[model samples]
Target: MLFDLHEAAANRVSTTQRRNTTTGASAASAMASSLTASRANGLGGLDTAFTSTEDLNCKENLEQDLGDDNSNDLLLSCPHFRNEIGGEYERNVSFSRASAGSPGGSECRLAEPALSTYRTNASISVLEVPKEQQRTQSRPRQYSIEHVDLGARYYQDYFVGKEHASYFGVDEKLGPVAVSIKREKLEDHKDHGPQYQYRIIFRTHELITLRGSILEDATPTAMKHGTGRGLPLKDALEYVIPELNIHCLRLALNTPKVTEQLLKLDEQGLSRKHKVGILYCRAGQSSEEEMYNNEEAGPAFEEFLSLLGEKVCLRGFTKYAAQLDVKTDSTGTHSLYTTYQDYEIMFHVSTLLPYTPNNRQQLLRKRHIGNDIVTIIFQEPGALPFTPKNIRSHFQHVFIIVRAHNPCTDNVCYRQLLSGQTLPCPHCVPEHVPSHCSSHWRNDLLMWLLPH
Candidate 1:
């Protein structure tokens, strides 16, 4: 099937990476392409560009992090990561869902085994902002062209030949999955061009090699991945994801109850599955009329805070356990659900509840239905105090669910992405995202949340 441009972009670079292009010249940086204007944050100071050797060192640093011993290791590893035909390597291409649905999906496959190491030669040039604009801004202005050189040194280290899918504990099967990078805007640029224009183009082999290794780890083969009792999904859940209090979670199951619980309600109060309640207290054990009515007697602030403790039932309705709901999209006709609670405390729940409309739709719009399920973890808005006791408690709850729910025996689900950190998946062959997902984005969440 064809991949979405935005999804394809995210698949390429990994959310953990900071994509910055540095050129050899100290010339001023330029604005991102017109397409990137909407997403551009601001110019990455290109006036202070990296020298060529320094650039190489940056690439080396990334390689070392991926476990490569040296540059020699990168080249030898390239061929094994990418497919070869007639003694030459085949360049992988990106495709949309419609285009990918065809036979060429085989072309998108990574070279058998994938590379263990990667290298790249990315360069960034400075984009100059006009003086008139600069005066108005009163700050140093520069744009950048981050080359991001990526290639592998050893191709043979990963596999012998022929694409084979190892059953990682919790990964989707390695079929015709495409990979691409997305450049999201980190700041606004007002100098040379539109403040937020960027483009996501194809990445070199270096990025692809490293990305493949990361992806491999995320797949099921990296988990409880051996020929054995073939434990069902419930058992695998523990190994795949163990925490859930901050983010709304998603889990796919065969039961109707499980399916119905993941939806969104509109004008109708909560969907049939939802429950609500208002904080109230029993006054005196002696009489019913004497009971403390939160609406009339209890503290307002306390009752308001109680919203976090209890589910909000439909107006005047009976209390319902906040379950997941499923609904269709107004535009794409895709199905999704509303989140059960605010972001701060989603992980506290044992079961996966929908956090956003997109996540819920992913479950309902799945293209393939293997006997596997998916779990998504997210953090709520406020700071969730982390305590040793609470951490252990949360883990225990996750472990229990995994032990009871998953169905796969030999195969277990693996991680596509984890909560706090962002990184590239290793299975994908690096390529560029088209017109859809190129803009500047800063990976560090701290940078995003801190007071500017």
Candidate 2:
């Protein structure tokens, strides 16, 4: 079969050369005749007989040399023959190869000419591959729950419940103050890190009053009332506490003045000087526009504040409703204030700074943020990841980083939520102090505060 194919291919090539020579000779003869014609008359008697005779001789020679049995093989083996034969022969050849149940098998066995011709001449159309099939890459699997280190199960596991509250000591004014600690798992923090809502309760029975009962009877009663005139007992008793180290907690409890100041601040509210700074890092165009127009951060920023502020029961409430108090100005220097458990927190937002035409650093903004003891850094999605080294502040000992997670339905988020894994790439901070780190799905945001 191979020998016959080769012989047929050679004959077809010779026939093509002869046909070209004959056509050239016919063109030469026609040109000679037209040139020799009379100047008065155009070459109306141009001879096409030579071309017709050469074509007929070429076809007869091809038929005689290449029989019907080898004609198909010659067409298949020679690309020149296939081109001359027309697209119909190419389509039939492709169909035969495809029907053989192995499209690649014919390609492997064919010579270079046959393969090249098959590719160039084949009219086979293919539908585009679906997007799902094109996507071969997948995200890495998240860490398993067993690999996560959730802190000590709960805060209660650290010490006995209210039973051993006497170990802390008695308050001079409140008298025999009892301390109780309770831990609550923050819904958002469950997947990100070890962040829990901790509450410290201080109870004293020395101030409670009883009707027509002895002082001893009142002494044995539950410590519900307070003798202090300023803040109510119930209000002062249970205080929502941040994630603090054991040493810090010990220092606060041992020092009577610190405890007193904490209670007073909780009652009277924090002063303007004692405010949490709101710094903007890599704020995208959308957030910058919002800030320029309304002197307020974008939805991601508002969502972050809602986590710390009072939760209101309302449908489709604005970001400001029952949340942060905004003091807007024409100069873009707006002030944000919010109360957490009656404790005032004034936020110095960076975006609210006076517009500086050429100042990219915004020194004025940094100065305010730098002086603040605690600062919250709001970062927009797709922006550069924020790091503590980006800012130089002597007094800013604590940094609360809030990152917006756009398109929260990503596989990484789902896998992390399922496996209870920490962030894939956690931000690095120098002089690292472990604090509560959490992810809020409400606005698709991740937040973590580090205190040095």
Candidate 3:
């Protein structure tokens, strides 16, 4: 429900600008009209891989109107459009053709196909048009690597090349966070007998990389681990990225589908279940609120954060964390806590409250949000032994839960602290406690954004 069109437009993604392969509406329309008629026949051995409503309709329509005769001419024109080492896709391709020539002597033409020409199902019939017959239709299609729908295979190839996406006429900024794909290793599946494992690295951070194996078939190990629907490496990259991008688009448009999908991913074991300190600032938060559930829907939380400005801030939880009112009485831990490097330690959530002497007119405690807690089990499996030094290493990640002996009755006392005046407690402590402040935080959309 959160993924409706309206919300998607609202969360518009305006990344760094780059050249895009703009499509003409007329060409797309013509292509779609041609394909839909063939849908009945093309249904055999065809995989309807394009899931979105708009793409399916356009592609299907184009497939129908494709004339068997012109189909060969289309392929002969854009030999480079082939899906295989040979001219497979080009042979069956359908798109508007335009004239093109080689650098010095000969001629080369390619089709600048529109999404309307985007077809599905790999095996398509190709009728060879004679060289002389193809001469009249000599207008070659313009060649360009398409950005949005290059398919996962080409995308990986492009990534490995480090060529700007202009090689595909796509916005370079919109490309994957990872810059290149290293060599891939294939291991024989226990049952299926072959699968590829790849190591991918990001452009900005070489040290940071993702390594995962793509399974050819569900083995006993795979079924137990739950990749039943796991796609191949290229396909996984191809599939998950586009889906996430769509989720992003929908988010900008104002849909909460991204949130829903993230939760679902965790539930399906596609993503890790740990909160990683990134959480949604939920609805109905007040001084009395506690027990934060990251998966729960909180529409108002977005509104609150949006109003605060799109900027983010990240700060260590240590000093401010000491201000919360956390519980140690319970042996139970919140399921949200998962071991993250350096942040893993047996620790109780630290909360804070301002203590005021009877004589101090200023309040000692201020409730910025609520006194929520983040408790760590400290004894999870394979965890390092807890030490004060080791625990200190994770202090930066601890979420602060500030409570108070007495809530500030008015802004008069709070304003004094914000104004740079030391409103000291009657006990001689400073009234204004420094809360967390940072230029960027966990909620930043580019890196990774969670609700809070």
Question: Whose lDDT is greatest here?
Answer: 2
Q: In model 3, where is the ten-residue run with the lowest total lDDT?
A: 412-421
lDDT computed for candidate 2? 0.33
Most accurate candidate by TM-score: 2
Provide the TM-score for each candidate, comma-separated: 0.15, 0.27, 0.19
Please report, in order, the local distance difference test score of every candidate based on alpha carbons: 0.22, 0.33, 0.24
For model 2 the local lDDT of residue 261 reads 43
Candidates ranked by TM-score: 2, 3, 1
For 63-120, candidate 1 gives per-residue lDDT tens digits of 2111111112001111001111111222222223233222334333444333223222
Off by over 4 Å in 1: 1-127, 132-362, 365-376, 379-452
Return the TM-score for candidate 1, rounded to 2 decimals.
Answer: 0.15
- Model 3, CA-based lDDT: 0.24
Q: 1-452 in candidate 3: lDDT tens per residue? A: 11222222222342122123112222223453434434643666455564446555545333232212211200111110110111112222333333222112212222223335344322222223324444332211221221112122232332333322110112233333332233343555687544543333221111112222233333223343233333333433443233223222211122344334322322232222222222232222211112222223233333222322331111222222222233441222221122222222222211212223442221222121121122111111122221111111111222211111112222211000100001111111112232122222211111111111
